[model samples]
Target: MQNPKMLIVEDCPAQQLFAGQLLKQLKIQHISYASDGELALELLKQQRADVMLIDLEMPQMNGVELLRSIAKQQLCQAVIITSAKDPLLLNAVATMAEADGLQVLGSLAKPLNKELLSLCLSRRKAEVWPADFERKAPAFDQKLLRKAISEQLFSLCYQPIADMNSGQIIAVEALARWSQPELGMVRPDVFIAAAEQWGLINELTLLLLEQALQQLQQWHDLGVVVQLSFNLSPLSLSDVAFMQQLQHKVQQAGIKPELICFEVTETQDFTQLSAAIEALANLRLAGFGIAIDDYGTGFANAQQLSRIPATRLKLDRSLTDGVSERPQQRLVLENTIQLAHKLGLTLIAEGVEKLADAMVIKRCGINLVQGYLYHKPLTANDCTAVLCNSSEQQAAS
Candidate 1:
């Protein structure tokens, strides 16, 4: 394992030197320093640093401005130092910096304690790489997915999203589940990206749709008005042939188009914008609902949302991060809900990993919440069983 590198950007000479000494003591061999904001920005332009430690009060541009600059450059590491009492400023600076992917590793007060510095450095090491898929599972080959698809080796797990208020099993998000014949079970995150890299995302997606629609048809026959929500890949939206095939398959399923929802991550670039919009409009006109998935995490602006013909907004998981600590985050959630309501769009919150998180979302007036707290994604049989049981209970009550 390579030793992690650190970038210390402090305005004061003593503080910068102190950071350097701490890095040396920690046995971190590769260390870089920026005495002021300008030099730090210049250094970033020359070479990317693994993690950046920035002082909030720097001359010329200041730490916040440097953080923003680092973000514009697409540099991903940052740690902020400010006075202990000024947490609000620390948070404000962190949020502003994060917009550019310059995530704050941790916050350290001035007159940094050795223990605190060690903790920050350790945290910085963790954030150095954005979770490598291959390293985690070296045996999982990207090329193997092509064979997997050809061999019909993958499966879909449908996680039901019941309306909290109505307790109605309205929709299910199709999550990819895989159990390798040799390796046993592989995480979807590990294999899905591999599939995309190996040009099998579209194939995997279509397979899921076919399975989902068939299951939906079966559920409908049982008198269940279940809607199946399929995630839209950037590739799927851009491919005309895929869209035509999808249209044909939906017709073949003979299910109400309105009962099928296409959930896409929000994007501002609008690549294949006309084609994507046209296909989405066709789907909507055909009675299918369209939703913007992972709403707040994208580059979508207010005007962009107005232009898109989406019927629902699914809040990103990041919105709920640290909600318990930061009361103001509730305002963001509140405003998002209010905006969704104002736009006449159904709102669903994603990544509800805890019951407390769900309660917070419910109290904030969100209509639907999905996360591990409710259930992990289930197989088709399990999903059907859940919906049927919930329905029976509701009728009894």
Candidate 2:
């Protein structure tokens, strides 16, 4: 498989050359450069780049204008770079783009140093591996991975969601995981994003869901009843054909309708409220439970909840972050939980990494909790073992 490509669009020839040389020094040889915004657009039209390094002040068609055009095309990923230190201009551009495709990788003043170069380069390769990743872990074999997910090389890890009041295993969130001979244990976020950009997200999601549903069916047969939540991309839901195929696959799996919940990312542009609501309502009518995942983090308002037919609200981790100290956030959480209850929707608190956070969530009356505090997402066998163990412990207590 070919390595991902990077495009450097800079107005200054000297800076462009410097960036190319730096990438070369880092052993990333597939580098392309553009002197101005118009040239960048022309080159991008012919060849798609995985990442684009753009300078703000270009002669014909400045960076902001170019970014707007790119957004319209949805062509290439863009990272803005500018010497402008004014917070107002930076905030305006960031708000306009909002990390959808346009991300501010780094801002370096006139003189760029090795540290800045390293930061930018590291950010570019972030999709390859996660941050703070240790070399002790095996590096991902991109070729093997591309073939594996395509040929059923991935696996499922179920993270137990415990009911705080009862301390009972109520539900489990299905997380996609992979372990190949070449790549010991691959992080799903990294490979999943890569798969989406490579136009394999639909296939990967179907495969993972198939495996997860089969396993959930087995658990159902064993009488261990619990809901299974699966994360889904906005694009996946937007495809009508894909949804039909998914419905067919789910029927074949024979998993109960109410037991499966499809979690849509809150980051997606739900600006067309009527269309989104219509789509979600259709899914709900089809017996697929709908949820607004990463709840408070997205642009969605409480009004959208009434409009959309989502059955559950998964609160964003940010709201629970530092809740012990941030009284304001705690108040917000209290209100959100109450609001969700008033709407007759189940509330799920996600990212419960700390015991204190989990405790806070329980006190806020959020019944379902999922995160590391309960147990990190585990393999299918491990999932069953955890559930069985939780049951045993409850009986003993």
- If scored against the real structure, what TM-score would every candidate get? 0.68, 0.62
Question: lDDT of all the models against the reference?
Answer: 0.74, 0.72
| Candidate 1 regions with alpha-carbon error over 4 angstroms | 1-142, 182-184, 267-270, 300-303
Candidate 2, superposed: residue stretches over 4 Å from native = 1-146, 180-184, 269-276, 298-306, 392-397
lDDT tens digits, residue span 285-310, model 1: 88889988777774543554776789
Residue 122 of model 2, lDDT score: 56
Cα lDDT of model 2 by residue, 152-255, tens digit: 98888888877887789888888888776755676776777677666778888999989888888888777677788888876566667887787788888877
TM-score of 2: 0.62
lDDT of 2: 0.72
